[model samples]
Target: MRVLHLSDTHLGVDRWFRGAPTEWSRADDHLAAMRRALAPAFAGEVDVVLHTGDVFDRSRPHPRVIAAALELFTEVARIVPLLLMPGNHDRHGLSWHFSALPAGLTVVDKPCALQLAGLRLAAVPFLRDPAVWAAAAAASCAEGVDLLLAHQCFDGSTVPGFVFRPGEQPDTLGVQHLPRGGPVVLNGHIHTPQELRLGDTRVIHVGSTERTSFIERAEPKGALVWHADGGHVHRVDTAPRPMVIVRGPGDLRTVEPEALVALGREARTLEMEAEVASRGGWVASWPKPSPQMPLFG
Candidate 1:
């Protein structure tokens, strides 16, 4: 089975640097990345597009963002089946969207086993508790699951600077909780893309298609194409917005006009940041009171 794996699209996310109402440029950044990520699906290069989680930035996204997401997914689904497992960020919202979502788009949010393209795979969405996730994995074995689509942080998953171990983080899944000996488990949540061999199981973190924050600025954003025949996985690049961090406002003088510039903590004003942003550079207010800013969607 050839699968195009993508995660953490985070549609509808608004950044603080652009000021109160979203300019939709940041949303456009994510949307542009989404197009690159879904290119394979649209071109019939892959049999299925497996989106692990975080379809939207938040559960209750604006109606316009929801419409944009629906339109995109609906388009991709027309080409091939888009298998989605809701992640922690938008599980509740997905539950609502998939209620009347198109037939080509599927919400595999439960511990259910299904056959697709002659592959027996188990679909497990993001579960809040580690034990419950393990239980779901165990139940799927009855169907001889060969692939796992999950949205949880497993042991050894890394973010920008921190690594997650079984006991180190809340809701972290131990390696032992996985189905042993050759079942491929693709995960989400941790934005950094990495693949590790834990015992016989291959845990591949299908990182977000777009950089969600400055922390992921250094990480190469892309999607993974996994061929189940030999368990071989290769990454395909996505053209996400470039995130650049400057030490102070003075540094912005030499910054690239198209880059998402994270201003230094030099006590800058939003108006000043917006002024620089007006010149095509994505200027974000650094060290904002709320840490959830990602410049845009």
Candidate 2:
């Protein structure tokens, strides 16, 4: 059974490219990436389509994204069964959308297991409490399932400069909490496309189909075609648009938009805590008394 594993499409994410040859909406970029990535599936290349989570950028997706989603899933589900698990971004489930979806598309909103195209799939949506998530995973794996779908951060998943590992970070999924061997686990949440190990379990971080943030400018965007019987995964590039982050202390006007843009002068940092965070930019806010920092040992 060959499965196309992709996640964090983050549709409706309209970003402005600081430096690009032509101006285009990132909302269109995300939708295009998804459409192209699923082309193979539509061509009868894959047996099933698995999306770990973060179907929309936010809990309440706008009308355009919803329409695009309906068009994509509605068409692809016709060719093969689609198993979509909601991620943290999808806070409250997309009931109206999921409810209207066709039979071939199964939304793993809750912990459940089912069979699709002779393959057994066990899934659990994003849970806040690690303990509760572990219990839910244990329950889902109690019975053997060929494929396990989830939306969580496993130890060792990376972003731009940081890595999620075993530490005081309570959200990291532990090795012991997972079911080893048997089923191949596919996860979403982290945007970086990479493979992870939780003890003996084979965890594939089905990364975002397109880069969702400027921090992800250096990362390649694509989907993974997993051949279940052979246990092999092949990455299919979705041709993500280039995103440039203007940084450093240099002349911004002379910087070329096509190749590399030099930053001699840094963009002015914001003094407000919530403003920058809301803008999807980094902000360092110190706690009352933190003789502690989990990000670094």
Best by TM-score: 1
Q: lDDT per residue, candidate 2, 156-236, as tens digits?
A: 888889887655577877786786454788888989888976667888987898877657767888889999878999998
Question: TM-scores of all models?
Answer: 0.88, 0.81
Q: How displaced is residue 105 in candidate 2, in Å?
A: 1.4
Candidate 1: segments with Cα more than 4 A from true spot: 18-23, 249-254, 267-280, 286-297
Residue pairs clashing, model 2: 249-264, 249-265, 250-263, 250-264, 250-265
In candidate 2, position 161 carries an lDDT of 90
Q: Could you tally the backbone clashes for each prediction?
A: 0, 5
RMSD of 1: 3.4
